[model samples]
Target: MTAPEPYAPAPQPAADDGPTSLVRAAIWVAIGALIAAALVCVVWVLIGGQNGIVGRAFLTILLLVGFAGATILDAHLAPRRPAWFALASMGVWIATLLIGAVMIWLPERYSWGGFSRFVQFLFIVLILQLVLLHVRLYLKAFQRYDTTFTRAVAIVTIILVVALAALLIVPLMLGEYLWFPDIYWRVTVAVAILAAVGTAIIPLVNVLFAPKKPRAAAPYPTPYAVAPVAPQLAAPSAPVADPASVAAPQELLPWPTYVDGATPLPMLPDGSPDWGAYYTGYPTPGAHVFGAPEPTAPQTDAAHPASSGYEGFPPPPPLPPRP
Candidate 1:
């Protein structure tokens, strides 16, 4: 049989469809949401939405965007795409889109007592999310495009983004560049414009310049290189495992079948079994599979030569004179 290859390619991972039930998880979600709402309500009651109608409008938008971001994060990081998190995240996205649209288009009508400057920030976030979603849906590493096509896409994106950036700011530019004279307002406008252009350019730049083919991961370094297989034969019969070597079992002797503490009774020098004390000593002697010999001392034999008599186990207490 042929030797096996050094490594087999790892299997590709499939997306998890995830569990069907989210009902069990809904209670925890509800509790968390309630706690958050209570905290926010308390803070707003004390501090109020950053003061003023414009400030309040901004605060409302900020809150919406923040909540949307958190939900999106939950969806992304949640284990196994659990139904509760997924549905909750989608619901948040929908709410954000709706509220953001209302605030952007009709700031005066639906504007709550929240900070106002945040409306444009929400717009920027919406644009970024949409662009990200597009990349995920359409970008394919396996599919290749002509260089000209990619360059065109990148250019068109850049132009559209620049136009949107202008349109997003032009209305506020009326009067003296901005309604609110605060330096922060100016900073917000600049940040929004930068974000818009960046959001457009980065993703397209990757599409245009990045290699379309998926880069194969470098094979892990191995101590030995495999001999190249010939293409002529269609996989010479799959390799068989080498037969394992094991030692044969040894046979056991019968007469001395080992059992815990199964022993013959002790003997006196006169060659008689000392049954009285021996029986007392052996309270729980184990019985061997092959019976032990009679308690007589060893007879003349090669296994146990006759004993040249010796003192008793404890020498029988100094002969206990005169007693």
Candidate 2:
């Protein structure tokens, strides 16, 4: 019979947890921001509003677009549906608007400027949250890809985030004590621009250097071919001997089939002792003794006929008894 083939282990599926979608979203957001900036300039010219109004509107829209783009990217990259990112962003925006209105109404009704501090605090918290969120997303991407480029990018992003945080917090601290620095706004604007540029560039670089997918291996063969049949010869039947012409079969000596410390002989399919195996195995009597005498027939004696009967001998002199 033919032997069976060896078994091979199955290959595992690749993980689908990369930030490709986020990278694409960031690219789109950058393009949209550029377009929005141009449109804002046109609107400012047409409405002829105060320069402050245009500046504030442009900055607010830019921040909103950045946050919205990030939210969309996160939702697309996430494993599940329902886009929790979109929902969270919407909730935060609505809450901020409502709180700002309440703060404005309270200050006007009670003639208190302290309520303005609350509005500033809320804005600071929101900015901090957005910064943290971006940092977290970038860190996650770095971990997932685990490449040299990604590591460098992650480090750069983290450093920029730290610098931006310092710029923002330092100004706020100074403002709280009524000691605003002359270059505070300039430093803040410079850091913000640098961070935004870096954020936009990171995704583009990641997408460019992303790993390619491996091709699938060929499958094993099905329904293995059947083993070829061997031709068998039929055993010949033994001829029956004539009763009167045939001589009687000789009887074999009654010797031990097994010896001490020897293994039992194996049998054939027909349940007969395999003599070929027996001869090839254990040694026979007198096999090791050189010039050993062959077995002789037993001597016969007239007084002990029974002892000589095995050799078909007539009686002869018997052996004397021991003293």
Candidate 3:
């Protein structure tokens, strides 16, 4: 069989569709509404407003409706065509503007306290909706945009953010700008205008400039590069040993066999058998002398009397002298 091919890295999946422009548009509008509300709050606090009637009549109603309506539209448009959402959003926008107009022209008791409260509530809801729907939309769009465009957008956003923070802290610099009220207001207005324009432009710029094509990543190194390799050195040779230095051959000896029913005892130095001490009656041949045989024990009366020597027996020997 042919050699198997080497393994390769798997390819990355491509994104088919990114987020739509309607979502990006929603983000712009939401930020605009928030900043507008914040400015209105500061302005209202300075200039003051009627408490009961205007607060409830315009600000509260408009804010709730706009936020609620935008959320509903987002939910509906997410799955369907973006154009439908855009058209619906336009209606909400027009309605909000009209509400603003009514608040300005319509007669009411303008209490600063009530107006401030109303503005606070309005700003809260709008900010919430903006976070949920608009910011999410911005994130989705950013995900689709290329790295270069994303970085540019990020830098611009940071600059605008610093400007907004400066505006928020503007009242602290009142003393320096107090002598030239015209210059101070002019600068504040310019900053506000720039911030609004930047808010509007960011999404549009990203949509226009972000790369449309999905970039292909660089290819991986081939198998030939990763292969196990031998070092460049002297060529390998067959291992050999000198036969003369090897161990000498050893001789095999035959074992002795034993006779049937007999055990071989180890030989004594004189080459004789060594019986144990239990057979003591046997003569130790060279050292001891033998005497006459003694009489045997009788088996019958007649034999017994003869053996005992009652009548015609030999006389007994006399005793030896004492020493």
- Give the candidate number with the greatest TM-score: 2
lDDT of 2 by residue, 213-301 (tens): 79999865432221121111124538767667877544432221322213333333433333443333323432321121342333345
Q: Least lDDT summed over 10 consecutive residues: which range in candidate 1?
A: 314-323
Q: Residues 102-173, candidate 3, lDDT per residue (tens digit)?
A: 343333334453454345334533433343354335445665654765656645654554454444333332
Question: What is each predicted model's overall lDDT from 0 to 1?
Answer: 0.43, 0.49, 0.44
Better of 1 and 3 by TM-score: 3
Best lDDT goes to which candidate? Answer: 2
**Which residue pairs does candidate 2 place in steric collision?**
301-315, 301-316, 302-315, 302-316
The C-alpha TM-scores of every prediction are 0.24, 0.32, 0.25
What is the RMSD, in Å, between candidate 1 and the native fold over all Cα?
Answer: 26.2
* Superposition TM-score, candidate 2 onto the true structure: 0.32
- True lDDT of residue 70, candidate 3: 60
lDDT of 1 by residue, 1-323 (tens): 98877797878899885434463354345346645654554455466533354544455556656665665465545556545445554544444444443333332422341234355555655654564444333333212443565556545544554455444444432322335446655765665575455445545656767656678998554432122321121267554465355454243222111122333333334333334433233212332111234333312445533342234333211110111
Count of clashing residue pairs in every prediction: 13, 4, 7
Q: Give candidates' CA RMSD values in order.
A: 26.2, 26.5, 35.6
Model 2 residue 106 distance off true place after TM-score fit, in angstroms: 19
Whole-model alpha-carbon lDDT for candidate 1: 0.43
